[model samples]
Target: MDFQKRHALIKEWMREAASMILASFQEELTVEVKTHRNDLVTNMDKAIELFLIKKIQQSFPSERIMGEEGFGNQFQDLKGTVWILDPIDGTLNFVKQKRNFAIMLAVYHDGIGQMGYIYDVIEKELYWGMKDQGAFCNEEKLPVVEDVSLKEGLVAINSGMFATNRYHTTEMGLASSGVRMVGSAGIETVHVASGRLAAYLSYSLCPWDIAAGKVIAEEVGLVYKKLNGEAVDLLNNNGIIVATPKAYQEILTEYLLKK
Candidate 1:
């Protein structure tokens, strides 16, 4: 497969989709709750999903797509080329703060991630990775992150993880220099991938939430695993932890796996 060509095409689709999202911000969003009030779906999300789905089907009819807004393929198996799309990650942040949200997309072939893209929409920064080609932010290549220990580096966690003490993450946070809770999983994972945060722990994420970030994290030598230290299953609603290798082992052994 021509990965470079595919990468370029995906980026083009993302750029146009981004424009659509930005335009929606100017208009009043028609919002609806998905499973709960906090779980939001706007007309914009559906629109972007449909747009990207159409583009992908037209370009690669044989490939399957999994999207957050349910506008793509319904297949559960990642047998062939599969595209995972999260048109607007952090919908609450988008609706309330109008920032901190991201657009995430990833491609996996036979369950192996081939490429990933996370665009911080308001920041206008794109973080991307190609399997063995390395990861990048904008035009600059991102260096492999050194293994910063828990004591020396900050950590990112969400409220649910802290409230429930999921995987004993509250204790894990105490071991770190500090804790940050960003509403957007994409942005938080980018911080880990970029070395700005030593670890990021989140409870209960769908594949689309971490799909793009996982590829970027792995490219930079960050460890991506289930919070319980199990291998991540892309099809499951798994609790996840992305951290430097050293921190990951420590968190897993001392905190998550201690009990």
Candidate 2:
């Protein structure tokens, strides 16, 4: 199959899905809890995911989907063509700001990310990538990451990751040039992909949260790994470090060490 051609089709569908999200932005959104009070789901989230599912089924009937809204299947492994999707990556932001939330999706074949797309629904900006074509923001080609030391670079992490015990990420990220709390994994990942931040650290995030961004990062020569230098596991939720090669290495060595 032509990965490039599939990417083009995904992008168009992604944009259409994004537009549907915008139409319901300001209205009162129904919120529900999943595992905990902190874990939230909005009506828009389900709507968008369902819309994408219908679109994907109509357009790519053979592809399997694994999505956050539970509209897709629960899979053990991603083989053949798999689409990973997050209808609304930042449900809180969509509820509050009606912006900053994004629609993230990835298409993988044979366990490799073939295409990725992240649409910042509010700004109408789309960040997309393919296996070797590199990443793009809107129509502009994204510049490959420039090497930067972790100490002199910025890191984005939500409050939850910093509060955890599995890694010394809190100290490491603080020691960097600065730290940003975006509350949205998809947004932070886009920042890392587009070179706004040197890295993005998040612990135990769903596939929909980072699948698309992983493709974008890889295309730009970034290393998308775990906190302790393990490879990113596509099938599980875990801490992730999306960084330029140099920054990723620095993080593994100089930081994330037990005190």
Candidate 3:
């Protein structure tokens, strides 16, 4: 499928998207609530989604796209080439901090992830992975992360879930060295892939939230799975855990599943 060619084009598009996002900081953002007060969608989010979708259509008109801004196709199955996008993964962070957010995109062929990208706009760091080609941050190739046990390393968990002790998340945090809440699934997933954190857990995350991160993280030998240790369903939202292999097994066996 000429993955190298596509990868080159995708990287170019991500750079363009990053430029657009950075430019928006100069102008006043038009923000609105999505499902709730904290769930935000800015004008830049819709603009970036539309912009990337346009670029993809120009090059790969036959492929289907699913975007968080609802500018792309809506379908029930992943039968053909499909692109998933999250224009601004941490919209609240972008609005409040103007940093720590990322743009995430992923491509799948017949439901198998072919490539993924996570672009940290402020940092200008692009994390990407291609099937069997390995994962990288900028020009540096990422290596397989150590299989650190849960008790030995820090963990990241959804803030609300940890505070509420949902699914015994607080206990899981206590079992680890510490807990962090990055507020962005894309960034947290990258942290795990780069060995910055031992594990990442979220009570609920949409397909776009974890799609790109899953591809990139899994390529670095980390495990991506549902809380119950099932494979993620790319078409639906699910409780997720991305971690080093040993941390994954320990998190499930000792914390999440224990009665």
Candidate 4:
């Protein structure tokens, strides 16, 4: 399919998926904890995943899917078109605050990202990108990331970064103008995409947590790198950071790697 045709279909799928999510929001959702209290699941997540899977199967049957909730296909290779989906990227925030959660999707062809979406359901905000088409927030397009000093930048990192001995995020925090942890990678990605923060640091994240956001950020001229200052693999989970080029250079050179 042409890029325009595919995108129109994708947007339609996203809208249908969004309506399902809104319907779920109005009821008393059944909730379950996954690995810990901080990791959560809800009926909404499952239902939304199912809704998306059905659409993909009916509309694009050949595509493989990797979904957070196991409602989509499980594939070992990315040789063909693949969809990476997170029905609700911040289940904990969804269960607790009923906001800060997002439905994210990314489409890859032979391991290259072709299109991506991040939908903030409560705020009705959507960020989307097509590899060369640039990134959009609602109807407003995002501009390229800018160069700035650490003192002029605010980063969104995981709160655990400060609480743990890992990566010296506490020291990084000390050097930057400030730090904020919103507990959701999707939300953090939104901030970085819009230049609300120059960077976002997360030590542990799956593909679903960062795939769509990575594409959008990259389209808007930000760098999506592994915490070690390497290019991010769209298919793997790792220590990931999204940042403006200058802030990223500074963080890697000055603040990281402390034991």
Best by lDDT: 3
Each candidate structure's TM-score, on Cα atoms with residue i matched to residue i, is 0.97, 0.94, 0.98, 0.95
Residues 177-241 of candidate 1 have per-residue lDDT tens digits of 99998799999999898889999988889999989999999999999998888888988788899
lDDT scores of the candidates, listed in order: 0.90, 0.83, 0.93, 0.84
- Candidate ranking under lDDT, highest first, comes to 3, 1, 4, 2
Q: Return the top candidate by TM-score.
A: 3
lDDT of 4 by residue, 199-224 (tens): 89998899888789988989988878
Off by over 4 Å in 4: none
Q: Residue by residue across 204-227, what tens digits does model 3's lDDT show? A: 899999889989988999999999
RMSD of model 3 against the true structure: 0.8
Looking at candidate 2, the ten consecutive residues that score lowest on lDDT are: 161-170
TM-score of decoy 3: 0.98
Ranked by TM-score from best down, the candidates are 3, 1, 4, 2
Q: Backbone collision count in every prediction? A: 0, 2, 0, 0
Model 2 shows how many backbone clashes?
Answer: 2
Candidate 2 residues 1-259, lDDT tens each? 7876676777888888877777775577789988887688988889889988998898889889999988998899888999999999988777766778889999889789888888888788899898888899998999888878787789887678676734677678767898888788888888888778898887778878878999988998889987778877788887788988888887777776454
Judge candidate 1 at residue 84 and give its lDDT: 95
Instruction: In model 3, state the lDDT of residue 43.
Output: 96
Error of 2 at 249 (Å): 1.4
Candidate 3 regions with alpha-carbon error over 4 angstroms = none
Candidate 1 residue pairs in clash (backbone atoms < 3 Å): none
